[model samples]
Target: MGIVVDLNGKREPQPSLEALTRLVAADLKAVNELIVRRMHSPVALIPQLAGHIVAAGGKRLRPVLTLAASRLCGYTGTRHIALAACVEFIHTATLLHDDVVDRSELRRGLASANAVWGNKTSVLVGDFLFARSFELMVEDGSLEVLAILSRASSVIAEGEVAQLVTANDTETGETAYMDVIKAKTAQLFAAACQIGAIVADRPAVEKEALESYGMNLGIAFQLIDDVLDYSAKQAKLGKTVGDDFREGKITLPVILAFRRGSEAERAFWRRTLEDLDQKETDFDKAVGLMGRYQSLEDTIERARHYGAIARDALGIFADGAEKDALIELIDFSIHRAY
Candidate 1:
């Protein structure tokens, strides 16, 4: 997210943690400003759709993590800005394509770029953003960074395809679900942090630790996201609840509930998947079944476990405020409201 930490050398209310977060804040803002400026394009339509999606806004968490990882690795250079922007561009492009694939009307509390610009324009602009991201990466001129990010992109695409194929299948279990989340979410998180260390010339051990941290954090983040889709309020959630079900996308909580549910609950799921326009009562019935199955609590515990694993990996780093901040980030992902 556009980090709002104060970088000034002022006495802050939060005491010892302020200064550490402030350093991250300065670096985060610089990276964000650079990405915004570099997002311009000569082709009016391309820039138009790209700008709409970029300005639609997100937490910018991936790029922020990249910058934070660079600072944590003791990198003292401006190149991290371009690299951060590259991560964000790749992320945004994926969101654009995703909205089209999901046929989503809303994102980040606003109209999705595809909803506003049409799928054809949205897809083309997304491709343009992807190409532009590669150009930025090439400018950084690190084969290590290139290799890490390119492979992540490939894996994420594969995950998207796999998820699409398995979307409405009740047979999809935890193993299949984990594969989808790891590819779709964790790949980028791992690459963002790993490449940050790579660009900073950190040792392999530290780099691997950061990659492990990112992967677990990503899994926890996406699992929580899926949980919230079924459990959160509509206004607070920004999107409709039961979206995964409505879209025929089987996520972790639903899968868990279906696996543990009664025969009647299974029949309800069949109807929901086969008929997208199932009654509101059916949605309530499914929600109640999920509760009956304790799927929500199970999902939360799973997310908490992954967050713990992520924090444990962070411990491999030498003691520093950055390491503590990383730990706080894992906690935040587990406890976040939105």
Candidate 2:
């Protein structure tokens, strides 16, 4: 939906995070500086390993949400900057642990911390990041913010455990998959947004609205990520296509494909995903099955549904550049597959 073509057959520019990034540019710079300063440590490896992942360069969407949300709610204070850094720390910690759990070698096209340093160091650095996040939260000196972020941290851990239970299980349903992503991914988004309203001393209604927007946007974001795992375009973008398939991670695409396939196809899924007895050709075969079942397309459609909800949730906010950028972010999140 984001793509457009003129009579000349050239694809027009699609929706992007540029607007949001530009809107929060200065605050983002502050957050980045704070992150670099806080990640420092006397233990040489701590900074080294942490710096590696930090330098790997992601979109920093979670922290951006914090910055944008605070501005949207008319906050003029500097508190959001440190809090945004806190959110980034939480996200970076999760990525470190996730790469270790998945035995991944790459992150944002660079060697993952775990791949370079071993699982022990990666995990310890992740713990350090988590500790740093909590320290930032405490320094903010808001019990409500503390409660929100602490709850998100616990929910994220629960989501990871839930995903582990559902992993490699072809019988996992769509509902269960949604639950895992909402917790592991969306909980922090919600917290990041809600705290912005809190810091601004906005009303409860505004807080709830922003929370809902972040939650739904996060779900849409993860759904597309799952679809990207099977997309050829993902490889060009530096992500390893079919990582989910190789890891036996039962994402929405796999769940839908397995549910719709014939009995023979189901057995194929069990062999590749459940039993983890995969040959090199299995990834192609799996992608073919997903194509046959229209699973990838349907997953995109599912993402659109959540994106719609996220857009609507922003209805409470007044029209401004912050709101506009945030709304565009929903489109960017869903249409990034292109």
Candidate 3:
């Protein structure tokens, strides 16, 4: 029931992002074309590197949200096409920057841009993408759209800063961590969905509903990401099992486990995470502690709670393929962690 059917016409346990993409296939094609067109520059490396990452596989979820939201609002114009491209540019820029900041060696199971071209090139290219995103926003010619996206860009930066401040603190509370995810990750999602309503000239209530759906969905998405880092296979998760642990990134499972563990467990987290004094065995120990506290499962349950909110936010809309796809996407996002 998660999806209609795959190309092979078999039942799928959940709706694939590919199925969602097919729902707005033509618009996604235009968005891809615009992505390549806008990334063009006289500087060869700018386009080359940008193309490499853009062509690298991604769900294009943010842009897809914009496109689907427009359709859900019953808009038929092509304006959403360019604006969808804008959302993508913003997302790509953030990925380029995140890989650099995390000092990551891999992305999407490939060498990270920074790893291949050095941190300077990666950072500059990220800046270039950000500038390109602004240009697309300007071209869209909607002051409201521009304002929402611009504020989202600033909020994303603030979220990154907040994460840096809270990193490896071992005392990062659920509230503070939620704030970081809301700002850094959810803000763009909220903006992306809201722009659809804006372009469709929908009223404030619908705009708020889509925004809420995006925000809650994003929280569910990131929470699952945190859980999968420890629980999912590398092939499934597309990153090392302990990347967060190695980087000392404080996420929900770690937050919950640390708070719920014994005194010795707290000292252990301090030794490995706060002190960055880790050995190969440390990851195993950390995993054991997380399991002992039921942290991973608990985190996924929290994600389900947010997923329910995301679904409810869309209740104002009648049942249809778009709404069903979005609801399925929420389930997909949460279950991907398992």
Candidate 4:
């Protein structure tokens, strides 16, 4: 809520991804090794295509969640390493599928997997990753872990399909949008964090606590992504600015702006977004309207609410560097848009 100076730079006192990396450095390294090891295949193109996306340098937050939460619960075993890798594979598979669904050309500052390789290849590789992830889960030999992850997988798919169904219609309510994101995005985060407790043989109360943290954090993360789509410069944000607009995606910002605008403004949105009749200046006009209505700021503010919840969910853990970093990570999710 303080003054946002550089729309490109992070807010002051934001959680450093590097700091979190350092906290989980050794486990992360082992997870990365396991990721590479499990990705190998007799089929030449499988590893070739999957490696391209893996090498693209995503933040790896999902896997880090697994590693960090396990350590937070004082788990010291090596099983968490492979399980962390499984989390990454699930995330990577979703990204591959999302790019194809979104028809995105660029991914994480480079060509999307579907862009460089064909859609068929991208999808098959995604499937392969999913299968590989299950292999690791089964190898871990915990039916509870498998049940949690597989349920997450199904919920994620349902979330995507729900979003797809809601795609261009301007009548989508806040409740509907919340449901879609909770399923599509927050479910994975919840599952990822909860698995850390499972591996630690922690009690259900601790598992639910981690799940709450991850779920709210994921909600905050996606809400910021919605804010950044309109507020960030294309080069800095990586994905093209106004992509959601172009794709006729109904994000929170657009939803707020649409609902708050005048009849003419609503008509304009319907013409461009609902009717797929965007002009070059339409994007700027949309931004102007959103700014006038304070939609972006409002969206960021909502993100901060969920972030606060994510932080409070960690109250059960005693104070330590791990707990501190996790709290900061929540701040990082909301403040990254600054």
Candidate topping TM-score:
2
TM per candidate = 0.91, 0.97, 0.95, 0.95
Clashing pairs in model 1, backbone N/Cα/C closer than 3 A: 1-59
Backbone clashes in model 2, listed as residue pairs: none
After TM-score superposition, the amount by which residue 109's alpha carbon in candidate 1 deviates from its true location, in angstroms, is: 1.4
Better of 1 and 3 by lDDT: 3
Evaluate model 2: give its TM-score: 0.97
**Candidate-wise lDDT, in order:** 0.82, 0.94, 0.89, 0.90
Q: Give the Å shift of residue 11 in candidate 1.
A: 22
**Candidate 1, lDDT over the whole model:** 0.82
lDDT of 2 by residue, 106-134 (tens): 99888899999999999999999999999
For candidate 2, the per-residue lDDT at 311 reads 96
Model 3, clash count? 0
Task: Write candidate 1's Cα lDDT for 226-325 as tens digits.
Answer: 8877776545746677777788788888899888987887878877875565886876777788888888789989999999888888786777877777
**Global fold similarity of model 1 (TM-score):** 0.91
User: For model 2, what is the C-alpha lDDT against the true structure?
Assistant: 0.94
- Pull out the clashing pairs in model 4: none
Best candidate, lDDT: 2
Going through the candidates in order, what is the number of backbone clashes in each? Answer: 1, 0, 0, 0
- In model 3, what are the clashing residue pairs, if there are any? none
